[model samples]
Target chain A: MAKILASSKDAMAHVKSGMTLMVGGFGVCGLPENLVHALAETNVKDITLISNNGSVDNWGNGKLIANKQIVKLFASYIGENSELAEQFISGQIDVELVPQGTLAERIRAGGAGIPAFFTPTGFGTKVAEGKEARNINGKDCILEEALLADVSFVKAHKADKLGNLVFNKTAQNFNPLMATAGKITIVEVEEIVENGELDPDEIHLPSIYVNYIVKGEQYDRRIEKRTYSSATS
Target chain B: MTGVSKKERIAQRLAKELQDGYYVNLGIGIPTLVANYIPDGMDIVLQSENGLLGIGPYPLEKDMDPDLINAGKETISTLPGSVFFNSAESFAMIRGGHVDASFLGAMEVSENGDIANYMIPGKMVKGMGGAMDLVAGSENVIVAMMHTSRDGKSKVLKECSLPLTGLKCVKKIVSDMGVMEVTPNGLVLLETAEGFTIDDVVNATEAKITVSENCLVGTY
Candidate 1:
């Protein structure tokens, strides 16, 4: 029986330096804010932060970049993060720019028990570099390997002591898939209730994939860019 | 076809055609400009192939949330009832014809109304996101493109010389200088932007453009 922790700091106690971590969140929508803050506090260094984008300027994953905890990052979009841009351009961080969708699926496939899937997504571009290409039905597709992380971090809406998670609507983003893919998936929920408290059907993430659970500290849910029209309608 | 300078001129013309309550997927580049001109309180549903369901317009500077973005990987706000999913499920929405309309940017549109915008003529290219699926799945397809290439080559042609992304998928076209619609009969001349004439359009194009009596020049 897994015991529920009170805070992200407790749930993140097991994480160590040099570990490969996969985090969920498209932009910052479903991010694990508390656990991320916990990771930021710890002295762990040289982590491979695998997520959709590097957090932009003092936000979400950007805090990790600021802490210099992540030495290598494997993701699709770094356009949001000026710190990441500086680090990459300066060769201080190693970056692998996977196609956005491909990166998401590779992690999903890794957790789905599928070793690899062929896709036409990155066949001819640099995303196909050093990868195997096969011709199927006269069309070329490159075989991209599944990616697995030593630990996965996810955000959840509510959780029971048994670790069943209920994500609030769009907050379900990458929580469920990353749950299944990581070897040690840590979920930081907004609230934790008693066992059997969460509705069975409403459970976005089952207990089987969750290794640790904690309550989120706070949420600012910062946005990246804002281009607007200032006119009276 | 219109023979005016493209850039923002074409974006403005396409924005005027947008109706309320449409499920729109804006293609990259010029097509993304449609977001800049959405009518106030139109309630259009914007879909992104990257798995967002309820995309509102881009957020303002004070309200910017780094986490919310559209398919172009730029930050965006969401309307109520927005959902998230894996890429597989997102493609299902695109390939399943659930989208009402797709507004795309094209490299060329043939007389037969074929579109070629995914690949370049030479060298390797990036992956096709959901263009093929959008072409086949959307109930309606609208193309917004420039009348001519930078070298003064016509994009509205008799036939597409480039690789086609979708066969006869285009319905209406909005260009810098003109608007055309693919009909059961043939390409119907709709209108041209201000400062362009039929012969000027024909001269700028590499193909033989058809003219109609209802060709009034547009102002937007």
Candidate 2:
């Protein structure tokens, strides 16, 4: 069973400076907000982060970027975070832009104990540059190595005492995959239920992948773009 | 159509290519506008790479859910049959060729169907997102954009000056001036947008284009 923690401070205690971390989210959605906030308060520096996108200028992983905690960032998109862009432009940060699909697969591969995989997604482009290439079944493919992290911060809607997780709607973007890719997976949940309260089949991630659980106090759940129909307005 | 802008016209023209039961992915910018022009009664499912399928219209203000959004990160609603999955599974559907078509915006498109849209070197370096996978795996790829850059240089080029997102992938292009098909023989002009003459398109296009004999004047 995963150990239940009362606050993010306890969970973040295991994180050290210069560690490789995988953060689960697509922008601000599904992000482990409490853990991120706790990490921002820490004095840790030179961390390497792997996520789908840098959240916004003042929230999520962007806070870490603004705090100068991250040295390297691996993400599919960097359009949302101005701080990250400024740092990347000024040579203060290093960024490796992976294709979104490829990024997801690399994390999944890491959790599955696969060293590397060949994919056709980035072939014949800048992403394929400096990588091994081959013609397989008449399709041009490029090799991409798996990505693993020292720790992972994941967010879920609910978790059983046994650590089974349930995520909300489209918010489940990278949480489950990142859960297994890290040596120590720390999850922050909105609610904690009894061990048998959660249906076994409904669990999105099994307890075997989680190491610690922190009950989140707040979820801003900030929408990056709040587009709505005029009729409804 | 008279009051429509070039971007809207491009999206309007691209919407006509959709067939019933087609599962399509729309890139950000003008490609997202294609959803507004989808023909009524057509059964089309929109896929967002962030992990959603059967994406519906923008949510009503009261029904907005921060957890639910499109690939562009805009708040959106899901249709009746919409399903949500993880990013890995979402990309699996994309890379596995289950997606029928993908409409994307481009910075430059070569006569040979090579696309350069992700980076501008030291100027603008936004990441590629899922464009590489979409172009590589979708059954059909279509580009939607303006005919010329802001400075009047034609974006339809003999070779892309910017870094490529994909090579020999784009099958068609719908721009403000006209609709073009990328063929082994080079670009073929299939139609000219309203208010633009064939000579105007020829002059704006830097790529060598052959005008099809059946070329029609586009109504939209």
Candidate 3:
């Protein structure tokens, strides 16, 4: 019940240099913007970030990349961020590119207390290199270890005082999974209701996984890419 | 110089493969273009690995919602009855073999139907998205790509020189110049594009190809 933090500044104080952090988002969707910005204002450095592509250059976890707070990144794709790509090519930062599904399963497995799982996803591919492989059901499967983070930053559509979360639409992509996999989970919600106010069926994440919650401020909801077609409403 | 651009021609042929009620995942590039060519009245449910299913057409300028985007980070509209979940569940549907088909773009495809689309060593290609998972889980894997690189190197090869996305996972390939089915024997030429011939495909292809007796012209 005391999980609510006074502000993002108060919440970001828990982070330190060289910590492994899980940031939740797909593109800019469901990014905990205020929390990320607050972390940027601090002097935290040499952090390893685990997320889905982080964000584009100007928003989401991209801010952390820009601030040079991250030393290594594990993501499915880094196409959108020119800086990240440049840094990767220059070896300024370490990058581990995981297949999207494997990334999700690894984090999920971590929270489930499973050490490793065999998946057919990367068999016979570069992803299978140096990994243990076994024939499962006549398919070559590779072993992928579970991934857990020191802390997680997630965004939610709504949360109750007790920390049950509801996410908006597709924005929920990696938030709930990262929440469970983090040793310390800090969430930013658009709105907060009383504990019993949230419907049980609608709660995407339970409070047990969350250690702190902060109401996000001045949400920009920046679009990663903008396109236009002549067809109108 | 052509009736349709090579990219569009490839996408057009790929669209024809969509079966009604197929739960399909389309990779970026030409695969994403297939949405523009979906047959009218066909109830194809497009799935995005970023956690959207029942995806609709790209919205107009007026209807653009900043929050609504596809896996490619392009703005898109959700069709009626569209459902959004987290990446875990979205991939659960994929790795659980719930998706009927997946259309992906590839750099090269071997005669054995092995696809190498994810990386080009020394060149900083974007990381693999859901291509590996889709190939593993989807019932049918279709590849849409150019027949040749800009340098005129044939992409249909006897073996992939690059990293493989999946081993012998591609069932069919729709390229700028032809549609070929990957068979045990080799690439089976199913359809040739306009102004292109079986001989043309054979000459251009690095992989051995078998011309089907019933090969038809591509409907570009």
Q: Which candidate wins on DockQ?
A: 2
> Residue by residue across A27-49, what tens digits does model 1's lDDT show?
67778978887889899999998
Backbone collision tally, model 2: 0
- lDDT, residue A217, model 3: 78
lDDT of each: 0.74, 0.93, 0.88
Q: List the residue pairs that clash in candidate 1.
A: A28-B67, A222-B65, A222-B66, A223-B64, A223-B65, A223-B66, A224-B65, A224-B66, B2-B177, B2-B178
Candidates 1 and 2 compared: the better one by lDDT is: 2
Tens digit of per-residue lDDT, candidate 2, span B1-220 = 5677888888889999999999999999999999999999999999999889999899888889989999988999998999989999999999999999999999999999999889999989889999999998876999998899999999999999999999999999999999999999999999999988888998999998999899887556
lDDT of 1 by residue, B1-220 (tens): 2543475677777777778887778887887877767779877777887667877766555665544566665666677877765555665666557777788998899766778775563432333445655675565888988889888888988888766666667888888878888876657667877778767765765554577777776554
| lDDT measured at residue A77 in model 1 versus the true structure, 0 to 100 | 61
For model 2, what is the alpha-carbon lDDT of residue A68? 95
Give me the chain B TM-score of candidate 3. Answer: 0.95
lDDT string for model 2 (A1-233, tens) is 69999899988788999999999999888888899999999998999999999889978999999999999999998987888999999999999999999999999999999999999998988899899999999989999999999999999999999899999998999999999999999999999999899988899899999999989988786888899887734
Docking class of 2: high
Kindly indicate the candidate among 1 and 3 with the higher lDDT: 3
DockQ score of the complex predicted as candidate 2:
0.84
